[model samples]
Each structure stands twice: as structure tokens, then as C-alpha cells.
Target: MVYIDKEKLKEIYPPNFRLDGDIQKGYINEDGTIEGVFTLDGFEPCTLDGMEGLWNEEKRLFIPNEVAEQGAKSLVGAPILAPTPKIENIREFFEKRYSMLDCYFENDESVYNLSTDEDVLKKYEDSKTSFVFLSIDMVKSTELSLKLPLELNSIFDNLFLNEIASIIRGMGGYVYKSVGDELIAFFEPANLLNKVDDSILCSDYIRVFILDYLNKFLEKNNLPQVGFRTSINYGEVYVKNVGDKLELNGYNLSATIKLQNFAKDNEIILGSNVVNIANKKWKSRMKKLKVNPRKLKKEGLHEGMKVYRLHNLEGRYD
Candidate 1:
């Protein structure tokens, strides 16, 4: 009973006959004429002489021949709407509907339908493609968390977190979620020159940037110098939206946590995969830049583990 607007039909339709009414019920003809009983859930293909019922019982969505043709060209498949009483006021309708579903609307206006399994799967798939997972925190955030006054702590968190988030965004990465002092970011492979290269570059840049920034902050505020450590990994992650809330899923989460656990003071640890790619691509450049590249012992270290020790110009660890 939910009739689509005639104008909107063009937007949804593919190149073919201009359909104006329900093609499944034999109402609208190829030339945009309405005939027969114009009752249809949506649209479908019909091999019958005039009109035919081409309902998709599995999807609970109708697809008329005209709409189906459009779908074929546009790759939209079909347009399905849930059967319900149409409310007059759009805002009131949505508010009441979401309330009835125990969902809250956000400023972002992203609608999350909790009833559909496909919706959930699509959400998970989208997240997997768009996120990079990294775990970043001060070398000893627990110790530092207790050292400063409540006000100073708040200031530090705000300043440093905002700066770090901005830096991630500047590097074409998205900070999807943060836990206290730790953050997870997603870097689009398309945005980077190469996924592995960009990941390493960003990781190294952030590590050094945070350290240098903190040193300056300490000097300016007359506080003790603070340092940080980080770990990064790459993998497909699902980004999910629960109403207004968003989350990321992938190896980035587990890899980041593992990296953080293995992170030593004043250093950044990258996943074995990242290290392998970096060693192959940037090994020569690393040597030219005077970076001491050492392969972690295969027997002692897991396969694919490569460690780079930052050193001074004299080849001494700083």
C-alpha cells in the first residue's frame, strides 16, 4: 500500500521503458499507462501477456519488470520497504518508530535497523573494509595517570588525544574508537601510496611526533618529560553502526593489543606482517638512513618478526 512517488521512480529505475505505476499487477504498461488491478508490494519481472505476479517470497519485496530492468543496469537489485502504516509527519513517525524499537537517533542521522540479519552483515562487512587498528598509549599511562592533578590530567588527555586524532586524520586515517589512553584508527588502502608503506610511515611519524611533542610540552609546562609506545597491524575490519554508535572490528584490534603488550619503552612495535613488508620494501632505504635493521632470531622470535632499532648517526642506539 506504500506507493512510491512518481518522480522518485526515475531515480530508482534503469534505462528502459518509463514505468509509472505497479507493473506487477498489470497496472502500468510500457508506455506509462495504468491498467488492471494496481495492487503490488513493489515490482518484479512478468512473462505473462499483460502483467504477472513476480513476488520474491524470500525477500518479502516485489520487483516489477520495469523496476527489475532498472535494477539490472544499476546493480541495485530491488527496492524493498517494510509493510507498515504510513505516518503523515516524517519527524514524528521516525521518532515514534525508533522509540518503539528501543533505538535512539543520533545527530548523524544514520538509521540502524536491528531486525534484519542482512543489515547486520552488511555493517560488519563495511567496517572490515574501512578501518585500520592501532593501539597507542603513553609508555606508562597508568603511572602518569596517577602523577598529575585531576585538572592537569584532564588537560593532558584533551590536548594529547585531540592532537593525536588530528594527526591520524591528517594522514588520511580515521580514529574510530578510543579506550582511555588507547586509540584505534582505520587507514584506507586507497588513500595511502601502499597499505604497508603508509602504515609504517604513519606509525613511525606518530611515535616520534608524540615523543617530541611531549618533550616540548614538558619544557613549556615545567613538567617531567613523557614518552609513548605504539603498535599497528593491518587486516580487514568490520565497521558497525548501532544506531548512533560506531565500532571497528578486525585483526587491528587483537594485533594492536598484542603489539601494545609487547611494546617496550621508547619504541613502536609493528605486526610481523607489517615488518615483513617494510623489510622487503624499505630495507635499503633504512640502511641508507642509518637505521640499524636487525632480524629477530627465527628460533627466538616468531617467523616474520623484524625489529628496527632507532640509532644515532654514529650507529649507536639513542
Candidate 2:
């Protein structure tokens, strides 16, 4: 059974009283009394005193199936007088919950299941396409980590990671993994080749966005500035569905790592493929902004070698 994030549920019932037990175990009866066996901290069926204080007609409760499976209570109650939760907030809650559980949250479980099947693999063997991989690493992460106090460091990490993930999602990219001070993302060639021009445009916009966002956040918090070196690569990568998880295998991964290593201080480097689509005009713009752009030599790149650079900015990327 799936579990909803408790924090998200709290947001939905902002001002209402929440029963403290696992919500899935309880359910509401037709008459409005909680009927199941679930434990409720502030509710007492014997007295019905708490019931009097609860909103009657507009009340709603969220119950997970696990609680019900445990033979817990049924009629957990919550007033619905609060505003409806935003879709984005709901998405974030689920994402955070799954991340905390160290589980992959499939947007479409059915698709994942079907794609991973042996029969499906035989049918779509040749039809499967590859993806481009990109990694963004925080520069001097150890130094930056040391500069911030423990409490502040935790706050900064949470804020920065979420911001970066949101940006990638907004740009139609998938975040493969988010490690200590870095995140890896992927772009499917099938989705990108159609609008190659748009993809290039989006990439540049996102890089600038990250730089600006970090700068502003640091300035506002009066924290030491932090910068990032990003490496992006394109190649034929095998994307496979493993149960509920998606995995990528190919040179793109290694290429992105190599590009990251090649990135100079406050500079962005582009692979031949990326430069072909982006053109020298974009490089000139970076120069005018005092951002240097370098081309990686063939010897410096590998089979999946792509583009990379360090972000230098005066303010945060909005």
C-alpha cells in the first residue's frame, strides 16, 4: 500500500485537527463517526466531545490502505475548512516521502511494469533509444560545507537540492540521482532531437538560471558564495526499466564525468555536438558576460564526451 507524506496531509488540513495514528487504518462512516480500529490520539468515541468541535458538513479525511489492512479504525475525521492543497505541493510531498524511503517513485507504474517485462523487451529491442547524461557538481563543496554552520548547512542543502531538481523537472529533464553536492540528469534523444534548437536554448537558459539563483540565495542569507561545474554529454545510451526503477547504461555517463574534470574555473565547455547546435554566437555572448567557453579536444573527450562548464554569476538564477 502507498503512504502519503504526513507533512503534505498536514498542509491539506492546515487548520484542522489531525488524528495522530496511521491514517490508512481508519475510515469515516456514513454518519460521520470514525468507525475503524485505528488509534486516534485526540479522538474518543466514547465521549464524542472532540466531535463537537470538529467541522461537520465540510469535513474530509485521508486514509491510507495500510492502516486499513492492519484492521485499524475506519472513521478518522478532519475538517475541510482549509484551502485545497496545490498540485505542486502535493507532488513535492510524494517526492519527498519516496526519497526518504529510498524508493523510486514511478510517475507511471503501469508503463514501467510493461516496459520491464521480458516480452516487452523482445518487442521493443530495436525501438529503444538513448539519452544524454549531464552532471552538475558544486565546486569546492568541502570548503563551502565547512563555511556554513551545521544547522545552516542542512538548510542550504535542502533548499539548493530542491531548487535544482525543480528546475530540471520544469525543463522536462529527469533527475537520475542527487548525491551529496551533485545531481545527475538525463535527456532522451527521442524527445530532444525533434526540437534540437529548443533543447539547446533550454540548456543555456537553465545554466544561467542556476548561476543567478545561487548568487541571490547566498547574498540573501549572507552565506559564502558557492558555484557549480556542470558537464553535459550526448550518446547512444541503453535505457532499461528495472522493476519500478529506470537505469541508463552507456558512454554518456563516463563522458559527463570527463567533461566535469575538464571544466576550468568559472568557465563552460561545449562538446562538438553541443557547439554545432549552439553555434559560436552563444560562446561570444558568454565572453561578453565575462564567462569563458572552451572546446574540448578529441583527446580530452571520450566516446560519450559532451559539454561542460563552471557557473560564475553575480546573482541567483531566477
Per-residue lDDT of 60 in model 1:
47
Question: Each model's TM-score, in the order given?
Answer: 0.49, 0.48
lDDT (C-alpha) at residue 277 in model 2: 31
* Candidate 2 segments whose C-alpha is farther than 4 A from its true place: 1-128, 194-199, 241-244, 278-318
Per residue, candidate 2 scores C-alpha lDDT tens digits across 54-160 of 12222334234333222222212422111111223534543443343211122322212101123322333434455556567777878877887876675555555
TM-score of 2: 0.48
Tens-place lDDT per residue, model 1, 81-102, is 1111122343453233323221
Of candidate 2, the 10-residue stretch with the lowest lDDT total is 108-117
The whole-model C-alpha lDDT of candidate 1 against the native structure comes to 0.46
